[model samples]
Target: MKYFLPATLSAYLARTYLVAFLQLLGVLLSIVYLFDTVEILRRAAKFENVSLLLVLEMGLLKLPEVGQIILPFAILFSALYTFWFLARRHELVILRAAGLSVWQFLAPIIGVAMMIGVFHMTVINPISAMLISRYQAMEANYLEEKESTVAVGEQGLWLRQRTAEGGVILHASKVQMPEWKLSGVTVFYFSKEGDFLRRLDAGTAVIENASWVFNNAIVNSKGRAPERIARESLPTNLTVNEIEESFSTPEQTPFWVLPSYIRTMEATGFDSRKLRIHFQSLLAQPLLFAAMVILAATVSLRMARFQATALMIGSGVVIGFLVFFASSFLKALGASDQIPVLVAAWFPPVIALFLGMSVILTTEDG
Candidate 1:
């Protein structure tokens, strides 16, 4: 690899690629932040307590998550522009005269993309997860006017649900994993107008299909003395799977945290399909980034005077989006358990890489 491109040349190319990537990222982030701020402002209008500063803060907190979603497109366009600029300045003509092959130059770009993938997994994702978690909390508090339906903390496991008569808040001091049982359970019932209706303290509670069965429960209502019952049932629309999703959503979980969290979900009788797919997808990001570089380079390595830039770029953007949408479709299939996780995660990147390489080989030879 050192022989393929001299150390200085490789450094130069990588530097150029990185500068373009960061510049494009900044541009896109600015545009998204502006739109997000506007949206947050509109949502905060009904709340007298929500200030303009708060709206801006909410948008800034949300921007990283949106950036995570925008990253692949940014890589594609920036790499494409970098290569086109190189060709436009006749820099390639100079390199060609020096006997440098396309691969000699492209290897550096691929390496940069791989590093970016690692950076995203380690640095960007954790930051995004933390900020987005706060963003969700703020959104729920002011805009949505509801807390998360499920949460797990040092205090215990908590859940909430709406009933025809009112709402119920549940707290479990201890959750028996794999057995799907809770001990030291309490349920607070509230009327439709948010008045306290009653409370139930149970020795234990377990889910049986669509309801929670509480054992040795004591009922406390406004007018009546606490009544002990051997068994009690509460009908609910919540399943264990939905509760798991609400507790540890992929967006709110960092990449470093996902594996153990997935295991926890699985241990709690949840299949972990959604989290598994997200994990696999993140694992595949390096290859996907490298593939996008190849695809972008394939469309961009010619001058318009020498080749049709408009047609080639248009075709490239269309193909890039097709690849993106294809990956999304496969992810949806994986979520639905229609396809194997590995296939859904890795296939798009692998095939796109091969296809881009084939086209580059054919064109380079001709």
Candidate 2:
């Protein structure tokens, strides 16, 4: 049985990986195509250079970002397929007859799920962050060099601010959700609201405990300032949530930053439901995947006793989808305050786990 564990686990992992990679690749490519087409259409309408190669490049660059978003679903569906295949082949029956318990069968899938969770959090997510950042930069340069000065891109809002001290140019490339922090920001101050007050730029900016901490600020307050303080610090009463609210998109912040971001938002008297739900989603993903594997195994493992592959697979898929839908519904309900966020987050996984357990137990007892 101990020797059997490694072989069974390896087989399950291989099957899950193959299914997940294929499905995710297809889903991401489709999304990239649509995104690229929309951008090309927008540029061509303006009589700009929207070349075929440019569209291809944009699609290629955006796929990794989409992959990160779809990873959880990929894992779930892949596990389902693997377990279904195993049951359909009667391999599960053989294992059980050889005294392999349901828990033993599940150990490998659990291990794989943990590995995938770590991979998503560290490796895949960073790739998504980098690709998204590059995409914004390219889009920004394109907008700045080609069209109107006040135009916006896929990144976020860009504007010019005028004050007694001088004229300031603001570029906020991305906004963190729920509590709003700005990413890839640049602020320029001018003398007499025309020439320049100074240049202050940061890779990222957030309001923490009421003060704006500019990360990697580059300042140049050089010249024409009888009223202006030269080499002076810029003052802002903006909370992190406020700055985050100003950005139009939520994809700018890395997943690792959302926890602290939510804390910053709540501290500043902001609603963090959306961010909270997204955070909860991270934990729910692996559990959901585990349940899916169990459900698939239960259905497929009984093929020798029940010659209904099509019916079984169809029912299993429907059950999988229902589990997903139930989760989204519960999340929406929780977000509206009808249910607790924690309950909503765990509802799908818990329900699925019990359902899988009950089914396996009934079959074994019968």
Q: Who wins the TM-score comparison?
A: 1
Off by over 4 Å in 2: 1-47, 87-90, 136-194, 197-250, 267-269, 303-307, 334-338
Per-residue lDDT of candidate 1, residues 1-366 (tens digit): 234788988899899999999999999999999999999999898999899989999999999878988899888987887887788787877877787777888999999998999899888898899999999888878887763388765557789888888899998877776577888899999998999999999999999968999999999999999999999999888777767656757888899998887776654445678888888888999999999999887777754336667876796679779988999999999988899999999999999999889888888732
Q: Write the per-residue lDDT of candidate 2 for residues 1-366, one digit (tens) a residue.
A: 353466745676555656665675587568766876676557645536656666566666666666655555566556656666666677667767877776776677766765677666656665676677666555545533422133234445465544446555666676565445667777777677277556777776665554445676666567633232222334454444434344323355567777776665554444667668767866676677677666765675564357676776676668767876898799888878788888888888878878887887888642
Clashing pairs in 1: none
Listed in order, each prediction's TM-score against the native is 0.83, 0.63
Q: Whose lDDT is greatest here?
A: 1
The true-structure Cα RMSD of candidate 1 reads 4.6
How far residue 119's Cα lies from its native spot in candidate 1, in Å, is 0.5
lDDT of each: 0.85, 0.62
What are the clash counts of all predictions, listed in order? 0, 14
- Least lDDT summed over 10 consecutive residues: which range in candidate 2? 224-233
Error of 1 at 282 (Å): 1.2
| lDDT for residue 30 in candidate 2, whole number 0-100 | 85
